[model samples]
Target: MDHIFFFYFAAVIAGTSVLVVALRNPVYSALALLIMFFHVAGLYVTLHAEFLAAVQIVVYAGAILVLYLFVVMLLSIRSEERYHNQLPVAGLLGVTLCTEVLLLLIQSRTAPAVPRGSAEAAAETGNTEMIGEALYSTYLFPFEVASLILLVAMIGAIILAKKDIIETTE
Candidate 1:
């Protein structure tokens, strides 16, 4: 039952991810990416990480996808008629990476599972609480840094939009 849901989500995620790269139109590509993000949130739900699933949907599918669509619309980009001639190189690299991943998967399946320690104990503490503790305690500096970066980006975007508005009015 779980396997079925997992496979379905995985298949959609894989297909949409490919579409995200293969679609010629920027809007279509971003829409495909939005689908992929929803499927990823579904995957997180299946893993019992409900908080992560919510965050994935709200932060990625909600905010990030909206941001991407706004950028695509604002830029008014047109699709190019000719494709870049890097297909052969991309194909070769893809094949190499796929082979390496397959080998790693096979090796991991045969290896003995290591016993969990603090992580297992943390599981009893609830996902959201544990994440909160780590975010506030162990990872506070990195979390604050990420927030500061986002703040700067938001300010820069506002400034750019304001400049464009002023230019168009003048």
Candidate 2:
């Protein structure tokens, strides 16, 4: 059943997300985050948002996780070990944030489900096509701005990464 699949995917996402935060080793935490991303993509599929699922896998799981791994590898392990003492403070902050989010969720009541379009109509047109039409038409400027922001961030990361390499060689 759909409910069963949803629950399974949700469980994987929740477990992996917790592991991502709980793991001490940066590499292990990144791997756990990768698992969480894939499970989130699975949830997108369950929602019939296949394009979003693909983007989630390609962007987050593929590109972003690779970036995280590269950064983790580039950092000095001895320096990282020095930060072990900060874990307790980080854990306390994380717990506080989690409690706040849970309280917010509990206070918020779900709205009634409203269907935008019929399943048959959506199936006939396809979800991706509809999304593309709206994204390019109604949301074109915002989309372009987001892409530009991401491009800038990527370039900044590359510049920072190379600066470290250049410094070490000098």
Candidate 3:
């Protein structure tokens, strides 16, 4: 029963991800990406990590997809530009990478070992609480730095949009 839902969610995510790449229109691609994000969140839910599921939807599907839509709209890309194919080189590289991955998987004999951790400790702590403690206590600087990088990216997007407006007005 649970396996069914997980496979369904995984399928949807994979399909939407392909659609995201295959679609020519930037807006359509972004919408497909949004679908993929939600399906990923669903997968996280199946993994019994509700906080991760919510964060996946909120941070990625909600905020990031909206930002992608804004950039797509602001750019005002043309039909010809959207339809332009860089597929030959991209396809070759993609195929090469896929083959390499397949080879690596086939050649690997040993099953990956799981790290030894206190099961009782983990059972007492919810995924969200554990993640929060680790992020805040152990990885505080890197987390804050990521936030700063996102802020810079937002500012950069605003500046670029403004520059486009100014240029058009001139």
Report every candidate's CA lDDT.
0.91, 0.87, 0.86
- TM-score, candidate number 2: 0.76
lDDT of 3 at 123: 72
Query: Model 3 segments beyond 4 Å from truth?
Result: 74-76, 80-85, 108-118, 164-170
Pairs that collide in candidate 3 are none
TM-score against native, each model: 0.83, 0.76, 0.78
Candidate 3, residues 1-170: lDDT per residue as tens digits?
A: 99899889989988998888788787899899998988888888877778999999999988888988887788897544544377688889999999999888887757676688777987788989999999999999999999999999988878785657767777
User: Where's the lowest-lDDT run of ten residues in candidate 2?
Assistant: 75-84
- What is the per-residue lDDT of model 2 for residues 76-100, given as tens digits with 9 covering 90 to 100? 4432445468778998998999999
For all predictions, the C-alpha RMSD in Å is 3.2, 4.0, 3.6
Report clashes for each candidate as comma-separated counts: 0, 0, 0
Q: How far is candidate 2 from the true structure (C-alpha RMSD, Å)?
A: 4.0
Which ranges in model 1 have alpha carbons more than 4 Å from their true place? 116-124, 159-170
Which is superior by lDDT, 1 or 2? Answer: 1
Q: Which one wins on lDDT?
A: 1
Could you tell me how far off, in angstroms, the CA of residue 116 lies in candidate 2 after the best superposition?
Answer: 6.2
For candidate 1, the TM-score is 0.83
